[model samples]
Target: MTNQGTRQRFSPYITFSREEWRHLRDSTPLPLTEAELEQLRGINERVSMDEVADIYLPLSRLLNLYVAATQNLYQATNTFLGHLEAKVPYIIGIAGSVAVGKSTTARIIQALLARWPNHPKVDLVTTDGFLYPNRVLEERGLMKRKGFPESYDVRRLIQFVADVKSGKPEVLAPVYSHLTYDIVPGEFIRIRQPDIMILEGLNVLQTNPDGGRKRAPQVFVSDFFDFSIYVDAKEEHIKRWYVERFQTLRETAFRDEKSYFRRYADLTAEEAERTALSIWEEINAVNLRENIAPTRNRAHLILEKAEDHTVRQVLLRKL
Candidate 1:
């Protein structure tokens, strides 16, 4: 791995190599065990205890500090205004291309942050719930662009985040099933007032297309975030990971009778690889290039990963 100085300087972030970032973990003890990691890890993703100690521990510690600082600021503002204000949940947005391991990062951060003494009530919601139902997508001719921003009910998603940020006691969000690859009708996940909420998705950092130029309602999903992270990797590496995950799922989840991708389970290895590559090139790659990657610089932090699925560097946006 190259040192930070050797990397091209382009963004406003201060880059830290893996070793340099790992040193920031300090004395924070790992609260998670191997069994817990197995449960948190996504299919075809590798997350070891060492990786958590090196990468996520420092991240959780930094978030803890940020949460404390934000709370103090809120209290100070209330004091200056001479009025008591309700505490709102600290919202974090995690964005990345599919197979870049943002989901795993979100879950790990949720677990780690929850273990902290200051905030034990942490909730995670993926924007998958914000995706239009499969029938709706089909009706709108957006089935092929399922992960694109247009396939999501952006208004509803923004409303949910707004309500949460407004200190609502309880909020309901639609539930999505990976097995069915669609929203589950009549099902919703209820989140009560949590100390922290992690919203993870490919398009969480997306803004309005017009950039709020046309003075209509101009709320974006990212406006509610107190902090945001983008998990990043080279397109070629992410494409390989996507194909690998597809093959793994074909052998596992896709084999289920009720699985939406059951048809893929019976394909020969060569056919499966070809199909996965085609899907990557046609759908995932296009979305990453046109929609997802563009939001990487919008994140407060960027976790750049190596081909092995391990984060190799940390990029913290300069204050």
Candidate 2:
């Protein structure tokens, strides 16, 4: 079954099966090879070539058409106003719960969109960089809520996207290190002018937090997006994925002495499984229920996945 509200008969989205979506690809050649697919796939996630051909090829083609249409509309509007307005980057937002394969989806889309002739300068950025530094979280007593919306520098993140949307020549985003589980000091990722930009995160689809007060000016990160995608799966499936990924990391990244989770590397298999479950139950699951899942309906498209991490169905919101 699909997520809540998706089951409504009068829903705005048109659901499509995997086979139906695959048929829409037509003659679009798969631009990525097996090696590239391996590089893009996330830990404990399975994204095969067939999966890409069936799901992403058509998505990239659809996005290409949207980009072309948007450019034409921009030109027409400029002509009507008798002014040559500057072209800004087309922004796409990708949101999903942790361990739901959002990173892989964003990376694959970035690769495919960049290969398109119209937008060869596609750039991808994750909201991880916008997260408040560890020191700030600790000071605020929000270390346990690291991935929560309150843990982010929302104003700065919004401003960065606003600058890019306003056709700024260059914008810089802070750098985040997963191994250290913190932001790197004085490090930033520079994004030059590009035809397309993909912003990926767990909270990208969330609305303003004004408690419905209509104040002077309220803007959300998603306001600048031309399109948005939400990767979804059953809560049970996601919990299992998270535990599995945690175990895998314990054997690999957690073994690094400098890694933030180095202590987990010494856990026995049984102990590791129990610890992983406890972390998910106490932290990740709470965040998903209270913050992330509520915003799923805000996406223009929803890719629902199965237990195996394969996208089982596609739901495209009607225009």
Candidate 3:
């Protein structure tokens, strides 16, 4: 083959099937029990012990190694400068479409990585907290675009990530409530200096050259991340998951009087499914295609999921 033709077909990622990736688990042990995992998994996600052992265990071992190496480099830099520098937390960004289980992945990875002796403290912050309040979104006529990049208080979100990455002693992230579907008034999640931080959201890996505000920095959130992961699956599967989760929530959170989706609580099974599918097609799917999926290749690693919510392939970007 001609050199030019050969180069055209080159793939930058090393793809591994479930079994191939499972073997990479090596001596890593599963630290969480069945009960603990029950708490970690999402409403519609099918995360099991086998999934953890085959997928996350190996991934966590890899992340542990990355964190350790990064720490060593930080120390090395300080040594060369002949001065002590504050240890910065290793930030990990997990991005994917809504209802694609990125949140669950982030939690799993956080739980796994925290058990490692070297990096015992792991913090998780989701971008939902950075989304504009309902009133603000309404003012901007962006209620339908809640998960879109433009619906975020981008400046504040960037500042939060910057502050955390700068080793700030205390940082407060606004709390977002699923039931209320808004940023909780005056509520916040306090984050101390952690060994590692996992920031999960749809747009963590996305970059906007001109942000919504005049003073917003052009810096991407992934810029501060030492590593990034994109949880991926076929759109059809994700749509099904979304519809299923919405139906489940109707029986649970939507029944709460305070829920933003309380009106949906009375929907029939068919009506609920139709509504959820409509939402997927209108808002979430559009966001995924335009802003989120485009950034998948930006991730250092991508976890491709099967229809049953199992991770079928792990694609690690070649160095």
Per-residue alpha-carbon lDDT of candidate 3 for residues 171-235, written as tens digits (9 for 90 to 100): 99999999889999999999899999999998998776233345445587888999999999999
lDDT of 2 by residue, 36-108 (tens): 9999999988899999999999999999999999988988999999998766899999999999999999999
| Whole-structure CA lDDT of model 1 | 0.92
**How much lDDT does candidate 3 score?**
0.91
Candidate lDDT scores, in order, read 0.92, 0.91, 0.91
List CA RMSD, all candidates. Answer: 2.7, 2.9, 2.5
Q: By TM-score, who's the top model here?
A: 3
Ranking by lDDT: 1, 2, 3
Task: Return the TM-score for each candidate structure.
Answer: 0.94, 0.94, 0.95
Q: What local lDDT does model 2 show for residue 288? A: 92
Candidate 1 has its poorest 10 consecutive residues by lDDT at: 208-217
lDDT of 1 by residue, 13-107 (tens): 89899999999998999999999999999988988899999999999999999998998898899999999777699999999999999999999
Clashing pairs in 2: none
Alpha-carbon runs more than 4 Å astray in model 2: 1-9, 208-217
Give me the displacement of residue 71 in model 1, in angstroms.
1.1
